[model samples]
Target: MSVTGAVDWDQWLRRWDAQQTVYLPDRESRFDAMLDVVQALLPETLVALDLASGPGSLSQRLLRRLPKARCIAVDLDPVLLAMGRAVLGNFGRRLAWVEADLRDRAWAERLGVREVDAVLTTTALHWLEPDDVRALCTTLAQLVRPGGVVLNGDHLAFPLHLPTLQQAARTLKGRRLEERRTAPGAEDWDQWWAAIEAVPALRELCAERKRRFAWREKNDTPPPLELYEQALADAGFREVGVIWQNMDNRVLMAVR
Candidate 1:
């Protein structure tokens, strides 16, 4: 499998699907937060889109909360899509899984989704560069109907200064220490990182991708919250602000 340039969907799917058990739980909390934001934005059932919806966590949660809501879970990874189908098949007619790269405009058109009531994504958009992020926001603005919303539940902002990083590190350390003290057997961030490191296939994949991409520990780009808001505004969105925050996790909500 080719590891240079953009990630191939097939390889990504295989790696993720093999480690689904590890990933699924981590994603579940993020999806839970996303569902909360969605509920606050639109109390009633409405058509929704889940962008970069690996394994349909957000879509599945939305269906559980708003049984009448129709959701289209979009992702480029066929293996993950298959996993989503297996996990969320009980939703039957309410949920549809589509395999498509968010970077492609033609795929959106093919979905026949002129306008949706809302759009939600979690822990995925950061994979793209700033330009693609802006373009995605613009596309979403066009895709959502007036009075609709976009809830982005992920880490949208990170401090750049050393002091802030130190503070964040201290906070995270405290959280981890507390977790260990309270729940000794629970999986913490350290464990999560270790688990990923232990996965030979994932390590190999990351190593191969990093050589081509010039992997960096800290991103120099502007905070995702600011970038997203700017893009949303440029795309004709009306209201944009963070509605929820839990440490580094945030939910940025925008209205059209």
Candidate 2:
């Protein structure tokens, strides 16, 4: 439970695993879709980018699946990055962390690598404003090499006309997650934050995270999938489209 300078990585991974399931019950299925594409399109050994990676969730999962691949996991949250280093230990240098804000236009240069084979992001980019998302994809197009891939999975919503359907879909997923949430030692989002706050050693890091992200408003929702498609296309991607989807949460793929 000590998510500080010295954490029990196994225990932290367990908590993160449970919390991830609470957020996306079908996370593994979606990951499988992502992995399938990566394996099919990418080389046997490659360098990939993990955008806005939190606590090394997708990075670790990617390593577990593709042992030969190296990942550069980038995020601006020092708190999560600290936990990631503790839990993931740089993956013996195969997995590296870069502290850069995705909102910044020149973030790609901070990655140290000029270009990469693929870039993957999940449940993270939606936090950006519409303009920021467009800017990010434009930069992504430049960062990725020709024939490289970019995959982003998040709650890409439909327009206002589907309000009723959206609410119903949300309610169904919530109820389903709630049913299995009572399992022993499970931690929901609020509970996880509570645990982080209750720990004396983690307080300062958490405070810094709050200060960093306090500027964001809750209403900063993801734009429609069409906009994402357009952004990638405008970014000069050779081919861009949705490859996997489940209601609001879908993976958009683009080849640079």
Candidate 3:
């Protein structure tokens, strides 16, 4: 369903992107790097799963870049899903929105496809516990076609033993964000959600979103990179490696 009456969907999307940039100063850089990998490795008519696809941001970019590609954008947040459906409905059959929690092992089967060419996620999945991440990786291995790839871009921490490296990376990230503190109309993550709560048309969705995620105690501290590498490898991925990284921020690729 489209957002009711006089909503500037494009403007809302722009605001969302801006808010995200406040957290990750190089957000677009990571997106571009992921797209670059997709174009180089995947077929033109790829079918991809955009797991935890908040507002369909990654799906929108992927479809725009690979015109012939199709995507199943999956997420559980009702507010974000409504916004994504409203904005991306114009893509028709090329883009499908699935409201499924990533924590559900059965989420993959809900996409109505036996296999996809690729599975891509960004700035998501960190909320899952280590066991949940392992389960999700096992599902992805089965869902993605042979020789396909899974690209996960998020802040994957260094091992606890590397305290010096971790501290340095965190300090650099803080300094960079500090430089943009004065940017006009830039909202922090909380502010963005607050704005959404005030939108009359989205009020119901916001409430539903709250209920759906009420059990989520907090975002999990991301597991070390080694866990991800090992999980994918044990799940049957032939090769797993970091294709992109800015300290703890990384795009880990796994080939099935």
In TM-score terms, which candidate is top? 3
- Compose the digit string of candidate 3's lDDT tens values, residues 17-129: 88888988888889889889989998999999999999989999999999999999999987787777777884858999898988888888788999998999998888787
Model 2 agreement with the true structure over 101-211: per-residue lDDT tens digits: 888898888888998999999888888888998999999988899989999988787767899867766776667777767767668877977876666777788888888
The CA lDDT of each predicted structure is 0.68, 0.83, 0.87
Q: What is the lDDT of residue 245 in candidate 2?
A: 80
Judge candidate 1 at residue 38 and give its lDDT: 69
Instruction: Report the CA-based lDDT of candidate 3 relative to the real structure.
Output: 0.87
TM-score, each model? 0.69, 0.91, 0.94
User: For candidate 2, what's the RMSD?
Assistant: 2.6
Ranking by TM-score: 3, 2, 1
Q: Residue 100, candidate 2: how far off, in angstroms? A: 1.0
Which residue pairs collide in model 2, if any? none
Better of 2 and 3 by TM-score: 3
Q: Name the weakest run of 10 consecutive residues (lDDT summed) in model 2.
A: 1-10
Pairs that collide in candidate 3 are: none
How big is the positional error of residue 146 in model 1, measured in Å on the Cα after superposition? 0.5
Worst 10 residues of 3 by lDDT: 1-10
Instruction: Give the per-residue lDDT of model 1 (tens digit) for 109-213.
Output: 856679899998876777677787788888888899999998887656654455585467447645654654355334543454365445554465445434534
**Number of backbone collisions per candidate:** 0, 0, 0
